[model samples]
Target: MTTRINAVPRAVPAEEVEVPFADCYITTAAQHAALRVLRSGWLTTGREVAAFEAEFAGYVGAGHAVAVSSCTQGIELALRSFGLPRGSLVLTSTMTFCGAVQAIVHAGLQPVLVDVDAGTGMPTPATVRDAVRAYGPPAAMTVVHWAGDLADVPALAEAAGLTLDQIVVDAAHALGTSAGTTPIGSQCAATCFSFYATKNLPLGEGGMVTTNDPERSRWLHQARLHGMTADAWRRYLPGGSWRYDVAEAGLKANMTDLQAAMGRAQLTHLPAWQHRRAQIAARYDTLLAAQPGIALPHRPALGTGTHAWHLYPVRLAPGIDRDEVIAELAQRRVGTSVHFIPVHQLTYFARIASVPPAGMAGADTLFGQLLSLPIHPRLTDGQIDAVCAALADATHRQFTRKGAS
Candidate 1:
């Protein structure tokens, strides 16, 4: 008989791993919360939405908060509340999501694009001033906290001669961002947040609008449910009258109880999630700061509360092609994405606003070299290291022959 060796066999060729740009963290808490809502049998905009709104308002230090179908609705409602005439100018950042600009357009207001600061990637007070000077007497101004960077809201509002009512902040990425010691929502007129699946506070698809003014809060509440004084919550309850009138032309943009339940669970974990995000972001900052042909995102010297760290975008140095780096990263089975392509560059805005290319310098420059790495609560330390290593390696391979700037 032949003696057979007991050595392990060689492995087959491994397939490329699929990495996502962003991933949501859902645990038993989410499942339990969702199950509770299911058992209650009241799934629409009911008590859950109300409770979540109250809790979120308290968390953000706002007098009131209104849960809506989406952040897009929040922005649209904020614009609608202005009662601004058709074609009235509203200044906003060029480095923002299309939804921000689209909301202005949807509300019959003309969008005036303003460039952001190169370092912070946020709309500066001067840029807002310049936009206002160019398109003076604006009906409103939407200040977007781009990629969780708190823009100079107070200075911009003051420079633009805008009252608190005229300053609506699209704080979609700024759940934990602060202006000095104050939170983002507390400083603006109407602060809108996104709980979209990819946002810092993911509710799958939901949003909130917070305001210090009680009157505005009440209006938003009614407006969220088609301007009906009493929503289905009251209409369907026992001993509740079905008699209700449509007070005004409103939108069908109310958040469901299911969405609110998820929001509540997410909110409960927000503090810890935010802390972890910051730690990861800080690590990225420290590790990536010294890399050749790489410039990591900069945190301003002001705020102490938290950064939210919704995105950790870095700018590649001159002569390094961002697309090539992204391609290399993809080839290495790493995930990457961009925060935005610039509002002014999108085809829809270009057609309607025809915003000149020259004025949006910050947005243009940043968009070409910007690439966001995977940074979520679910990412492990090893994953973070892998991302950092891949990024550095990609930069070297892409920019080695070009010479350093």
Candidate 2:
């Protein structure tokens, strides 16, 4: 059940109905914002980054938000601040982006990869309880709100013998999501967001860290830019001193003005974009539900949280060849993707977390069957039908080929 992509290349007609898996949402305002930065003298982490940080923090209801180069760096920067000794254990899911596992390693902590909910792709309370039972309590934990579904961090914390104070949320997907009316940013010790081109609120590349902890917040601001007491923007401003000092060896992970300009523009439009995505997801749920053997993604519980719907992943029934189906969908001019290849399956992690055997029972079983359909805000209604029709046709063909129907 390894999640290897199919290698053979195939072509689809340029004039045929084609549905892209992901498309970046950009507006004239975003372009104008970026151009405004280009026109400004300060191109680095200057006023725009500061503005985006403040605006994002206000939106997420966090005390502070630090803009970083990327979410991977944000997580690494945050974990390093904790001063956990090298090899100190940290619990996380195998069913996530490798950056999470790599960040734990980069932060000088040993990652104990555990199983996730096979169907929903979430690391549940059970996953935490088992990891705690098998490896003992970790110094910290990182939880991903799988596909923008809010994780019950309170239950997860209780199971892992930690508190909400020790959990960092890999909320790369849950920017607009909420848990029981509380936005995700206010629900964890630290929350990291990505502005990768495909995210709900994307720039080409950027990230942010939001937290309620003031001391950690201040440390993060200083730590993002060479641990300098004052950034170039501040130091070069009027009434600013030329003299400054570095307090700690830190990262060059500061967000640039240009990136922030784009982020701010996107942030302004995020609510509208979120609504569009929700509409698309609701349509997909209705359309894809009719396709036999395709299991739709789980929505966030009605009162528990609002789903960000970052991805619209579906699982094929047992015995279907997912790779073949993807190729089949491609032939029908529909693009498709898998959310992740369980971290432990990667050769580098296999060597590092080799002990405990990656007992990723659930992720191991779920790997081959998952596929993400296009659900971006820009997708047109016609394209939606194309994608679903292609999926249904592809599924019927794949099952027929396998003689499973």
Model 2 agreement with the true structure over 260-329: per-residue lDDT tens digits: 9988887888887788888888888889887889998987767888999899888999877888888888
Q: Any idea what lDDT model 2 has?
A: 0.84
Q: List the residue pairs that clash in candidate 2.
A: none
Cα RMSD, model 2: 5.8
Point out where model 1 deviates above 4 Å.
1-19, 302-305, 354-358, 403-405
Candidate 1 clashing pairs, residues 3+ apart or interchain:
none
Q: Cα RMSDs of all predictions? A: 6.9, 5.8
Decoy 1 TM-score against native = 0.92
User: TM-score for every candidate vs. truth?
Assistant: 0.92, 0.94
- In order of listing, the candidates' clash counts read 0, 0
lDDT of each: 0.81, 0.84
* Number of the top-ranking candidate, with TM-score as the measure: 2
